[model samples]
Target: MRWAGRGTEPEAVERFYAVIPAGGIGSRLWPLSRADAPKFLHDLTGSGQTLLKETWDRLSPIAGDDRVMVVCGRAHRAAVEEQLPKLEDRNVVLESEGKDSSAAIGLAAAILEHREPGVIIGSFAADHVIGDQRRFRQAVVEAVAVADAGYIATIGILPSEPAIGFGYIEGGQKLDVPGTTAAYAVTRFVEKPDLATAREYVESGRYLWNGGMFIARADALLDEMAKTKPQLVAGLRRLAAAWDTPERGVVVDEEWPRLEKIAIDYSVAEPAAAAGRLAVVVGEFPWDDVGDFASIAKLQSGGRGSDLAILGEHARVLADSSSGIVVTDRDRLITLIGVENIVVVDTEDALLVTTSEHAQRVKSVVDALKLSGRTDVL
Candidate 1:
């Protein structure tokens, strides 16, 4: 991880573009994170800005307003634009349907590469809460340098705990890069392991949590993908050729569905790692996907994980010798009396009551809602 203080002014990262793949309803966040209104569209962190807007605020300085692009489903095109008014309409890469990260990110890379040959583009999830923008930008700058050195660069978060919820990246053979961020060739990417394995991974010191930030030259990213998914790359190129033209909709309708529905990790990253073409830049700045209510609790608590986090007009929820998380919309008064480690989410059509310990199971609740045909509340 690159350790540094926040700078006075962040300089624009030259030749570096950013793509935010704003897809996926955070199901674990349930009642709040609905299909039409996802968590990214709300201020889950109680930061007075939606997660997407926060992401833009942190990234725009580095990539510039014009250079930062958003790849989102057509359903979210309006929300993305509404949150980031400075973003150009042409920069919003609208997907007719969800085709996962590879299509979204790959198409962005294809268009950027076609427009400007060697621009370094980074794909960061729009919903991620990244603290310490100075350090994040510094790490990104280092990642760009690593990418310029002809390697697929990724940011790996330094593991703070034996987290079994995220993937792990093993750093091997440090690269000789004269830089601040520690750059290393990724030995392998491991999936979320068991609790015991996660503990071992944390203890090993060679492993870092996969923060899922990929930065590389647009051509280099596609060239690497060409090695494994050549046809996907070809389809993306065709789509890119029509990206800025009047035929964008026609081309997207014709080819987007046919393009591979795999993730960038499978389409390019993992393969590149195996071929010794992937590097991981250590990331130390605070980051979180806000995967569940537990995650939201942490973000809302101002880093004091044990504090009772109340989001959205906390004054309405009365607490009497109780501690936990309570999220309300001011529709009704909620009285929590002698309740410990409890979570209460009150929405118009749905309410979720669970403890932080059971927050991970919220996705199961969402799944059940879908199975029971109660998706309207979902």
Candidate 2:
């Protein structure tokens, strides 16, 4: 049988170009995920592989060696290079100034456009955790089919809990597209709801947690930005116009300082979602944004009632810690005696202690430190 959009012909698997935005300094993880050591670099789940490495492994098969790109800040460039030295320096586009996701994704889009026209690009966050790789790849394949149909596709995580921290996508109407089983025509893009609203959404069964994973053709995304966010488009275009030139590439030292700072969600995704120009796939994988310490804890083996003994019972203990996190750099002897719903993070310079429920507000602490010019702790 032929695919829906391909019209009586078996649709080919779309060539994928992955763009990983690895530029954030995770303050929630505090001293562990500091400015010098970004969250993507840390062993998020006590696994040997870091978050960034896990993301790369998932995308490497789909995007191949040259097609995968990582966009990060200049400060973290060498570290990122050390992590993934196989990727060329040019492919690892660095922002001289720390702009948000908007400018970062725009730069990535422009670079990919120069390489492949109408290429399907997957924008994966550098700090997410997916439990099942097979299911994750299946979702990507489905999203690619949706993108090939001239739609900006985003994967919506199946919300197991009423998470007020995540934005919600209402998706009930299945789109009639090929190469996909459950692609939805997005009806509404809801902002992060309050606890009450989030509860309602969970009950309604019409919403999925905004996964922050997006897929679209490079040109399509740029076109949407041009229509919805003209100024942002203009700024990116000006920077991209000189992309191949020796002047810009040789001395981004000068060119990058000129680009504006904004997040891709504000610049592109939110606006496009508001304008009814986005598609959503209810991703069939166990997914977590890993935005906070608690989320990371849940993904690991010692989550709920599970004894994950890297050592003896006395050495490692995570018992009855609902909605909490416990991590220590001291591998010799680390144990949580009796704690419920708390974040315990011990690092070289700082030790963070906070309630698990207050995980979302952790970013504010990072913000406060930055406001006070505490880059040493950041």
Candidate 3:
């Protein structure tokens, strides 16, 4: 984003801490995404950088490298560190086990709050794709302004279609929030609706796609979380107190697994919206969470020369009147003939074959593997 003044930073970014919660082993994008090396570690968008690196490139200018923090699972520690070599040892916090979103983000907030009381922190998902950096940063500045006003602020994407894959944010009245072009009061957050309901929401013009982006002061987030989940707040506070000390390992191992396992939406966001403590800034940028193979196909880089969307080398695939998305993870050539709307993932060990219509159900294949004790593939 261009600044009005010469050599100046964006508004409210001095104290803004961009906390990246890099958890979750993407199961739907499995075979390519695994427990040891998740999707964030790979270049899913065909960009030179990985998803996590792209996330850094977006926020580092606003939050600086010193204020950026990453939280991830213990298993992916070496990989994350290798990707982010400049990240400080104290900035990257590792969890002993995956305790869901609430624990991962809340722990990061508590630790930052211990260092600086009431610091502005924004949490962005690691695997989302943003097409417009200028519009996204503009929304971030507005969200930080809303956070300064003591509301748990979120940057909701303006819907381009009636997409049922993402949750919806209902906006209420517009408020004259300081340091913002426009801010709206969030009425409530709704889960992914069916096709008919999603269409109704889009037609009503009262809904925005929830991209899981949240920004607020550390104290405000913790205090709001305390109302619904006091036990989680207490345990996180204990762990935060010992985070910068030598006892960090001992405290995390002892209190981390015992913390409440829940998503931040249930723990703070939904309740805060009901009480009028949540606000939203509309993001004009094109965004996607990259959840399934269909989204992958759409985000794939190509000029529509054919119906095929390939994520790797064109030489890897030799198609004959076949149209689908092919993700080449190995050096072997993949040949297809007379295929339509198909999703083919070729890897070294496992391969995923399905259609775009059934891409969302790929997680059930992982479930079946678990049920049959086929941990080798998962």
Number of colliding residue pairs in each model: 0, 4, 0
lDDT of 1 by residue, 186-237 (tens): 9999998999999999999999988889999899999998888899999999
True-structure lDDT of candidate 3: 0.88
Clashing pairs in 2: 4-178, 101-264, 102-263, 102-264
Query: CA lDDT of each candidate?
Result: 0.85, 0.75, 0.88
Task: Please report how far candidate 1 places residue 291 from its true position, in Å.
Answer: 0.6
The candidate maximizing TM-score is: 3
Cα-based lDDT at residue 303, candidate 3: 25
Show where candidate 2 strays beyond 4 Å: 1-12, 249-255, 301-324, 331-337
Score residue 90 of candidate 1 by CA lDDT: 76
Better of 2 and 3 by TM-score: 3
List, residue by residue over 1-378, the lDDT tens digit for candidate 2: 212333322242446788999988777667668877888987676667888988888887666667788998878887787778677666788777787887788778877876677778889999888888777777887888888898889999888889877889987578888878888877777888999999999899889988888899888888886775676666676667667676566445555666667667766777777777788987767777777776775666544624332311223444543435567665444456565666776666777877667766788988888899987877
The parts of candidate 1 lying over 4 Å away from their true place are 1-12
lDDT string for model 3 (1-378, tens) is: 223331354456667999999998889998888988798887888887889999988887777777789999888888888887767788898988888888889999999999998789999998889999888888998899899988999999999889889999999999788778768999999999999999999999999999999999999999999999999999999999999999988987789779989999999999999999999999988899999888888677342424888886543788999877898767688899999878999888898999888999999998999899999988
lDDT of 3 at 338: 94
